[model samples]
Target: MLTSLWQRLRADFAMLLAFLGFAALSFVFLKLASEVLEGETMTLDRWIITGLRSADPTVPIGPSWFETMMLDVTAMGGVWGLTLITLFVTGFLIVARKYATAGFVALSVIGGALLGTGLKALFDRPRPDLVPHLVEVSNASFPSGHAMNSAVVFLTLGALLASTHRSRRVRIYLISVAVGLTLAVGFSRVYLGVHWPSDVVAGWCIGAAWAILCWITARLLQRTHQIEQPGAVPVEEEGGPP
Candidate 1:
C-alpha cells in the first residue's frame, strides 16, 4: 500500500509539472504573438537579423565553411529531413513490435506540423527583408517552420526514447541533444536571414508547449495500458516462455 501510494504521488507530481510547463510556454507564445502583431518586435528582429550579416547585408558574417555548416544544420529541420527521420524512427518502433508507440510518434509529429502550418497562415507574417536570404524560402514566416517542426520532432523523440531507458544520465543526454538540435536549427534560420529572431522564439514556445501536451497525453495513455509503460521489457527478451 505504501509503495502504491508513493507511485501515485510521483505520477501526480509529474503530471503537475507537465501542465505547468505547457501553460508557461503557451503564455509566452501568446504574449509574443501580440507583441509581433503590434510591430513591437520588429526593431529588435531587424537588429538581430542585420547583425548576423556582413556590412553588405547580402552575405552572412562568417567564413564560407561556417555558412556551409549553418546550411547543413538548417537542413535537418527542413520538411524532407524531418519526414525521413520520423518515418525511420516509426519504422524502428514498428519492427520492435511497439505499434502503439510508433503510432503515437507519427500522429504527434503530423499533428504538430499541421498546427504549425495553420498558425503560420493565421499570422501571415512576411520573411525578413532586412538582409538577403541565404537560403531560398517561400512561406509565411511569423513562426519559423524549421524551428517549430524541429522542436516537435526532436523533443518528442527524445522524451519517448528517454522513457524506455532506466538511466538518468541517458535520459538527460537524450533530452539535451534534442534541445541542442532545436536551438541550433532556430539559430540557423536567423543567421541565414530567413526568419526573424522573434519568429524562432515564438516557434520554440509553441512547439515546446505542443510537445509537452503530447507528453502528458502519452503518460495518461501509459497509465491506462493503452501504450507501453516506461522501461517495460519485452517478455521474450526476458527469456519467458514464448
Candidate 2:
C-alpha cells in the first residue's frame, strides 16, 4: 500500500506536469498579461466613449443596461450562489455517481474557485472607470468571478455527466452546453463592462488549468487504489482450505 501510494503521488505529479504542458498551449494568453491589461483599459474606455457619444435616447440597453447586468452578475456569482451550486453538484455526485468521483469533482471546483479569488486579489486590478457606476463593489477586478465560477462548475459537472455515458453524442452535447455557458458568462462580463477581455480570458485559462489538474490528480489516485469490481475478488472457502 505504501508503494502504491508513492506510485500514485508520482503518477499524479507526472499528470500534473502534462496538464501544465497542455495548459501552456491552451492558456498562452498569459503572454498577453500586459496586453490584456491594456485591452481591458481600452474596453472600459469604450464604455465611457459610448456613454459620452450616446446620441440616441431610444437605446435602453446601452450603458445603464450594461451596468445593471454587471452588478447583477456579480451578485449571482456571490458566495450564496456558489454555495448552492456546490451543494447541488455534491448531492448529485453522491447520489448518482461514485463517491470518489464526486469528491474529485467537488474538490476541483472549490480549488479552482479559490484560485480565481486569489488571482483577483493578488492582481488588485480595478474595474473600468470609463462609465458611471451603477453599483458599487470593493474587490480587485481583472477576471470576472462569475466567469471563473461558471467555467469551473459547468465544465466539471459537464465532464461528470459526460463520463457516465457511453454515447459519444451525449458526451459532445454535455461538453457543448458546458462550453456555451462558460463562454456566455465570460462574454457577458465584457459586454457589461464589468471586466476586461484579458480578465475574462485569464479567468478561463486559470479555471481550466485548475479543473484539469484536479482530474488528472484524481485519475492517478484512482489508478493507485485499483478498485475491484463487485465480486471480482475471489472468496476464500470458510471451512475447506488451510
User: Which one is best on TM-score?
Assistant: 1
Worst 10 residues of 1 by lDDT: 231-240
Give the range where candidate 2 is weakest over 10 consecutive residues by summed lDDT. Answer: 226-235
Candidate 1 C-alpha lDDT tens digits along 154-236: 99888887766678899899999999999999999999999999999999999989888988888888889888888775566
85-176: candidate 2 lDDT, tens digit per residue: 77887787566535666676777777778877887777788786554443455687766677778877777777655655557789799879
Any idea how many clashes model 1 has?
A: 0
| lDDT score, candidate 1, position 5 | 100
Best by lDDT: 1
Q: List the residue pairs that clash in candidate 1.
A: none
Please give each candidate's TM-score.
0.95, 0.69
